[model samples]
Target: MYDTILVPTDGSTVAEHAVDHAIDLAETYDATVHALYVVDTSAVDIGLGTEQVDRIRQGKFGDMPELEQRARDATGAVATKAADCGLDVTEAVVGGQPHGQIADYADDHDVDLIVMGSAGRSGVRRALLGSVAERTLRTTRRPVLVVDAETGTGSD
Candidate 1:
């Protein structure tokens, strides 16, 4: 019953698991996979793209280019994997609130399902209760499938 699936990647190992699950779902349903990588502006220091030190010292402000490149790399990897699975894939790099961006993207693209990791790159203690995943579940109108990186158990 799924025509479009979304998978958000932050270049984390947990996210990699999510990618695998998403790809499998796409293959089964013949759905198009959208790989989105968001550059978390909130995590950046001083509201700038640069690190905390650069923001503190006011020395530079060009870290955004590097961050964008990193985001592209992350998305590209997802796209590559999805393509290798013989699934239709669309990939993009965005900067904004992670949960908001993901939810908005789902709405804008009419995504049927979202597959995500239970934990983040920093390794959260709770699965499906992590900040982004929880917020996404609260915000999105579509169904969310959260896969535990350690256990590989998925709950929707």
Candidate 2:
């Protein structure tokens, strides 16, 4: 039933796990796979979380070339894997709040399904970091398949 499946990757192992799921589903449905990597401009003020992400966001452009490249690399990795499997693939990099951007992309593209990963945090960690997958699930009306890092082949 799925004709378009969206996978949002942050280049983490958890996201890679989600990519695996997306690829399998796309193969089964013979659907197009859309790989999205959000820059999460919101994190810019807070130092961008990771070292690589921080370095990229600090570049010259309003949304730096480095930042876009990182986003592309993340999406490109997914695209490459999907394309290698003979699946139709589309890739995009955008700067915004991650959850909002994901929801918007899904709605704008009329995606049938969204497969994503969550770090499954709790108590203080969950409270501070927040879960993009959880926020995305709350915002979007579309179907979402969440692969939990804590329970899956990924570290929280």
Candidate 3:
């Protein structure tokens, strides 16, 4: 049913958990998996967040060295996992608000579904910061398969 599946990763253990779900879906539908790493610009106003956003806005993803490494590490992990499962995977790194960026990526790329972790590293901060997966679900029209890393389930 799906031709392209999007999996957003933050290099967290929770995010890695969702990678398994995405790979499974991709294999089922014979779809390609797109691994996206969004550096949340809203989280930090200082170094990488702000700087990377400006570069991304200008369509320059190669200017920031350290941030690029981080993005590579995050997306690369997902790509490697999907590859091991014999799935075709693509990787992308961008800077923006996580939820919005994720939805936009899905729309812009014509993604058929999004499989993401319910909670990431923003554990304690979740109450105050809110959940990225929740926000993406609220904003996107595409089918979202949220993998609950804490419980190892895909329901919620």
- Provide the lDDT at 80 for model 3: 88
Q: After superposition, how far is residue 145 of candidate 3 from its true place, in Å?
A: 1.0
What is the C-alpha lDDT profile of model 2 across 1-156, one tens digit per residue? 999999999888889889998999999999999998877766664644565454443332344567667777888999999999999999887666889989999999999999999877899998888899989988999999998775654221
Candidate 1, which segments miss by more than 4 Å at Cα? 45-63, 120-130
Candidate 3: regions farther than 4 A off: 47-52, 56-63, 120-127
**Alpha-carbon RMSD to native, per candidate:** 5.4, 5.2, 2.8
Q: Candidate 1 lDDT, tens digit per residue, 32-145?
A: 999988666566655343454343233222545676677778888999988998989998766567899899989999999999986633555554346788889999989999
Best by lDDT: 3
CA error at residue 8 for candidate 2, angstroms: 0.3
Most accurate candidate by TM-score: 3
Query: Distance (Å) between predicted and true CA of 10, model 1?
Result: 0.4
TM-scores of the models, in the order given: 0.82, 0.84, 0.86
Comparing 1 and 3 by lDDT, which wins?
Answer: 3
Error of 2 at 118 (Å): 0.6
Model 2: number of backbone collisions: 0
Error of 1 at 91 (Å): 0.7
Model 1 TM-score, 2 decimals: 0.82
